[model samples]
Target: MCLLAFQLQKHPKYKLIMMANRDEAYNRPTTPADFWSDYPDILAGRDLEQMGTWLGINKQGKIAALTNHRDFSLPETGGQSRGHIVSSYLQSNETPEDFLEQLHNSKNEYSGFNVLVGSSEELYYYSNIEQKTEHLKNGTHGLSNAFMNTPWPKTEAVKKLLCDYAESTNEIDVDVLFNMMQRAERFPSEQLPDTGVGGELESMLSSIFIASKEYGTRCTTVLLVDSEDQVYFEERTFKNGVFATAQKFSFTIENPTA
Candidate 1:
């Protein structure tokens, strides 16, 4: 996931509400969100190149999402595919704390990346850039290519939008969340962060919904886990920056707990 905003245990009717967009090259082959035949319980869009996923969830209510950290100055170090980290966490029997501990030891094996792993009731956030895991508090949070909640223009904007929507609404609306993630307006050039990528590229990526020729948002996913443990997951795939298809799934998590 390239950009995401989520509220954890904050809303009245929902346990967790999240909206995310996955950005990638136009030619990268990908499969829309679905239950993998190999990993029956896992549901997520697959990056065909590496057979890994940026975000995913399982029947046991395990949730995981990842974003790569942008740094051009770093030397070329071929590391493990970061997407596998999400898939690995979802498939693991270990708790978030334990899994993160193990990941910290092998952090250098992967390129810089940020990840959120756990269930709706309790979640943990970690970034290889920081090398620490945070027991996410019950509140709104946002993350993007940088670190978690770094207040990059788009991150703060999306975070506030979620906070307002959750405060005004009593029930979760998948469509509303999707619309929020669809904003493509670019922030002013002066407001864009200099992540080592040149000015032109940085300006293009300033938008919450990136739309460029060769690379842009491939899909948008909105996931809601209500207090009753009902999971609503919807993904809209795009073709050349245009909506192509959408897939929706609903399930009641088995034995949901903190």
Candidate 2:
């Protein structure tokens, strides 16, 4: 998930609310949000290339999402895919804080990325790039390719929407969040990081929404876990060569202990 905005609370009707965008090139192979056959309780869009996911939720009320770290100086070491970190966390039995602590000590196992994990009791964030992991205090937060709460254009856009959505006392629903995500705009190409690998040049040559591309949002995703522990996940894909598409899925805590 490239951009994520959320409201987390302890309320009974809606304990956790999340909206995010999973930006990637159009050609990346992925299975849209659905229940995995091997893990029926796991609901998320799978990255077919690696048995991983940008975001997912399990029937036990666990939630996880990951964002690639934006850095030009790091070497490509063919480390574990960041999506696997999210999927592994969602499939674990650890609490948010415990899971983050474990992840902090095991960062060397995976590529640099930012991860978000949560349950009904807590929410935590981990960034391998920064080598830090901690719980998020009660408040709204936004995260993109950079650090959490960094004011990038997409982050700010989603943050503003989240704040606006939170003010209205009306019952929040998944569709409302999906509409907001769909309407999100991409950042200008010039703002993209210059990887010095002719990324800027390639961006100019092709319209693919590559992270290395000049400026564009490859995907947008939103996740909401209501007070009832009902988790909702949605994503929109943008490809330079084809029409865009959107997908959404929802799952509630079954038995709250699954």
Candidate 3:
């Protein structure tokens, strides 16, 4: 997940509301969300090349999502795929804090990443670069290539939109939320972050939706789990910046958070 805005335990009817866009290389092999035959409880899109996932929820009500830290100066290879962090956490018996502690101890084995995990009662945030696990507060929060809610222009803009959505009504409108992810505006050069990538490249990635010939926003996802434990997950995939298809799944969660 490249850009996301989520609210945990902030609404009266819904316990978790998350909308994220997964930006990946067009050449990377990927499959839409599903319940793995080997792990029926796990529901998420798969990174076929690496056998991992960017975001998912299980029958146990565990939820997780991952984003890569922006630092082009650092090499992007020779490390484990960060997507595994989400899948492993969702499948494990460990609590969110316990799993993050294990990850913190062996973080160097993976590349730079930001992971969000836990249950409806609480959500945890951890980034290898930040090297600290934080319990996310009960409010709408934004995430991108940097740390959680670091106030990137796009992050701030989308976060505010999410916060307003949560505050405006009890039922979420998936169309409106998904439309917010299609923004392609470039941040003013002065507002852009210098993450060692070239200025031109930075400009292209500055928007909420990233579009390029080689790499772009491959999928846009919206997930909502209500107080009744009903889950709604939808993923709209794209091919080289063009619309492809959407995968929709719904189920009742029975997994225990404790």
Candidate 4:
């Protein structure tokens, strides 16, 4: 996931909402959102090439997402796939804080990454480049590859939208969030982060909205986890190189003892 926006709360009907876009080379093999036969509790797009995923959730109410660091000039330190870092954490028995601590201590195990991991009681963020891992301070927050809440174009736009919607106190709606994402724009040259990555940065961020270009949004995913622990997962793909193919799922948790 390259861009992610989320709202976390203690509300009764909905507790968490997330919208993100996953950017990658088109040729990479992947399976769209579905129940993994091998791991029935897991629902996400699986990267066949890397055996990892950008975003995913488990039946146990564990949610995880990852994005690569934008520093393209950094020396290639061949390391573990960051996506697997998220998956491994979700599959573990540790709490979010514990998991983040472990991740911070093992930063050398992978390339730079921004990871979000949480269950019902805890939310945590970890960046290998910062060498810091801690629970998210309450309130709205957005993160991309650059840094936490650095005002990247997409992050800023989403933050504003989420703030507006949140202020309305309306039942959280995923469609409205999706529309906002579809309308998000790339940052103008002056607004682009000085990653030193140069031109490719422009291409990656700008191409998403340019019709003449072959790039834009690769996949858009929206997830809503209600206070009742019900999770709604929705994904839209641009096929034939351009256009949205819609898909959605709602995973409800039933109190087995009841």
Q: Report, for every candidate in turn, its global Cα lDDT versus the true structure.
A: 0.92, 0.70, 0.90, 0.73
Which pairs of residues collide in model 3? 59-255, 60-255
Top candidate, metric lDDT: 1
Write model 4 residue lDDT over 106-187, tens digit each, in one string. Answer: 8888877889888544568888888887677656778777777877776777878877887677587777877777763455
Q: Of the pair 1 and 2, which is ahead by lDDT?
A: 1
TM-score of every candidate = 0.98, 0.80, 0.96, 0.89
Looking at model 4, residue 86 earns an lDDT score of 66
Off by over 4 Å in 1: none
Highest-scoring model, TM-score: 1
Model 1 lDDT per residue over 1-258, tens place: 789999999899999999999999999999999999999999999999999999999988999999999877765444699999999998888999999999999889898899999999899999888889999888999999998899899999999999999999897778888888889999999888888989999999989998898999999999999888999999999998999999999999986534
Question: Which tens-of-lDDT digit does each residue in 180-214 have in candidate 3?
Answer: 99998899989988999889998999999989989
lDDT of 2 by residue, 73-140 (tens): 78654477778888888777877777778887878877678898876557788888788877888777
Residue 133 lDDT, candidate 3, scale 0-100: 98
Decreasing TM-score order of the candidates: 1, 3, 4, 2
Model 2: CA > 4 A from native: 10-12, 173-175, 183-219, 234-250
- Candidate 2 has an lDDT of 0.70
**TM-score for candidate 2, residues paired by index:** 0.80
